[model samples]
Target: MNQTFDVQGMSCGHCERAVTQAVKALDAAARVRVDLATGKVQVETDQPREAVARAIAQEGYQVAAA
Candidate 1:
């Protein structure tokens, strides 16, 4: 499944990398793409929605909405 999350507090390349790594840590094969300007994360995984949200939040960002 593919999920798109509306994230907040991402302002640079480092922020994007953080989000990507956090998501990948949960699912090694998961594909992550972040849009820093829009604070959005696109992930491909079968994991639960809340799991993904929590992973992103752990990276110090707010998961706005789906």
Candidate 2:
């Protein structure tokens, strides 16, 4: 499944890497792409939406409503 999240508080490459790492840690095969300027994250994984949201949140970013 593909999920798009409106992530807040991401302003730099480090922030993007943190979000990507957090998601990938949960699903090794998961693919993550972030648009920092737009505060958007696109993830491809089989995991549930809540799980993905939690992972991103754990990285200290807010996941906006879809």
Candidate 3:
């Protein structure tokens, strides 16, 4: 599934990597793309949306309604 999430508090490349890593930790094959300027994250994975959101949140980012 392809999902887009509205995230907050991502300010730089490090933040992007953190979010991507957090998601990938849950699903190694998952593809994660973060747009810092837009505070959005695009992910392609088989995991449930809630799981994906939670993982991102666990990375210290806030996940807003998509």
Best-matching candidate per lDDT: 3
Clashing pairs in 3: none
Candidate 2 lDDT, 17-63, residue by residue in tens: 99999999999999999999999999999999899999999988889
TM-score of 3: 0.95
Candidate 1 residue pairs that clash:
none
- Model 3 lDDT per residue over 1-66, tens place: 999999999999999999999999999999998889999899999999999999999988889757
Listed in order, each prediction's TM-score against the native is: 0.94, 0.95, 0.95
* Residue 41 CA displacement from its true place in model 1, Å: 0.6
| Ten residues in sequence with the least summed lDDT for candidate 1 | 57-66
Q: What is the lDDT of residue 28 in candidate 2?
A: 93
Tens-digit lDDT track for model 1 on 1-66? 999999999999889888989999999999998988777789999999899999999988889666
Give all candidate RMSDs, comma-separated: 0.8, 0.7, 0.7
Against the hidden true structure, what lDDT does model 2 obtain? 0.93
